[model samples]
Target: MSAELPQPSTTSLADRVKNILIQPKDEWGRIDAEPATVAGIYKSYVVPLAAIGPVAGLIGMTVFGVRVFGLSYRPSFGATLSTAVAGYIAALIGVYVLAMILNALAPNFGGQKSEVQAMKVAAYSCTASWVAGIFQLIPALAWLAILGLYSLYLLWLGAPRLMRVPQDKAATYTIVTIVAAIVLFFLVGLVASSVTSMFMPRMPLPGGTLSVG
Candidate 1:
């Protein structure tokens, strides 16, 4: 058998988050050189961070409730909890799917594909968006999560280096990958919603049943 690859150093999660968000160019360089495994990345980074949005949104909706047309409506706890769990699972699957897309499309954009490298790009580039999930704590402020669009900028910078794409083609690569991700997540959302609805009980509201958006 071949020799084992060196394991990545134990970098604190907070430091990694700060570096990726504050100085992604430098962070990408480190990410490209480090040895990482799919399990390690998911356990150390993706699992925890990806939970932020779903968990926060769960608390926001169930605790504070949603107000529409000067009326307050709260979804049933079972529905809210189930939706949160489904969304969280979807996020975990989404990252892996995105990495696959990045690796598959790498050669088309003049980049050499490496699964680990694609994963690093996919996982780390999402730091901004995951961090921004804190906005979900207050439904009204959830719109501020738009700031997470910075992840697109991070993807633009990291893809060329990690995927070995030429700078000239990086923009196209990033855009295509993003479009693919949108479609993938959209489908995933539909499936999750459909499945959740099948098991979710109908909750009566003042005028209608509580809808989990």
Candidate 2:
């Protein structure tokens, strides 16, 4: 009988998040070598982290409400819930699609294509944005969520390392990948907004009426 190979160790989600956020350069190295299935990554990491934004947004919009031009407007529960759910689903799909794009573009950048590595890059790079979702809990502080743009920097650092892209071409690769992701998410947002608007209710304001959704 042959001996079984040792199983790779798993890090707790908190530790993984801390490491990736604090020391991403080192963390990406571990992530590259870690044995992980796509489903495992999604279930353990992506699903929970991605929920932070949508859930927080739902609570913020319904409870704290949105303030614009000294007027406050609260969206209906149904509209808020539907938008949250749609956004959450879109985020999940976005990550998978991003990984595919990364893998497909590898050859153009002189990189080796590995689906698993691409997935790791896609999921881990989003850690900053997902964690920043906490800012969405307070409508007033929602603008802080822009801090999630740090994810782009994380991707720039991780892509060449994990995808084996040539150092000289890493910047171009990251830029192209980012542009593609932006277009994908923009389209997803338009669709989600259109669908969710059907549930929105009109709110009466001082000067006019507004719809919050």
Candidate 3:
């Protein structure tokens, strides 16, 4: 039997986060050089960062309260809790799925295919959006979460380095991956919302109003 290869200690989350956000052009090669497994990547990178979105959303909707149509209403603690759990799981799974999609489509884009490289690209390139998720802590600034769009640029920049796409084809590959990611986000959001609604009781709005949220 062949001996198993040892995995490198995963890179520090802070350094990885900092470099990816501050100097992505240089970070992709460093990230690709790291010896890591898909499981290690998820455990070390995806889980902690992905939690930012749901945790912040919970705090915003339940603790900070949402302003809908000029009225403030809070999702009950139970709804918030359930949604957070569902959202966290969805985020994790979404990364894995996107990684798979990226790897599968690499040939069409004239990129080299490697599952581990795809996972690295998918997870790290997402750092901006995951960090921007903190904006959800304030219900009003939630719109600022759009800043997460910066991840798209990160993805575009990293595609050539991580996936080995020709510079000519890099933009097309990144754009396609982005469109797929958007669809995945929508599907995950719809499922999390449905799950939340199922557990949520009718919330009472101000002035004797009952909202079937």
Each prediction's Cα lDDT score? 0.84, 0.84, 0.82
TM-score of each: 0.87, 0.87, 0.87
Q: Write down the RMSD of candidate 2 (Cα, Å).
A: 3.9
lDDT of 3 at 99: 90
Give the lDDT of residue 21 in candidate 1.
91
Residue-level lDDT tens digits of model 2 in 28-60: 999888887777888889999999999999998
Task: Look at candidate 2 and tell me the lDDT of residue 144.
Answer: 98
Per-residue CA lDDT of candidate 3, range 1-213, in tens? 997774865668898899888998888878877788888888888999999989999887776665666666666677678888998998899889889888988889899999888998889888998999999998788889899988888877876678888888888888898888888778977988788767553565232232334
Quote the RMSD, in angstroms, for model 3.
3.5
The residue pairs that clash in candidate 2, if any, are none
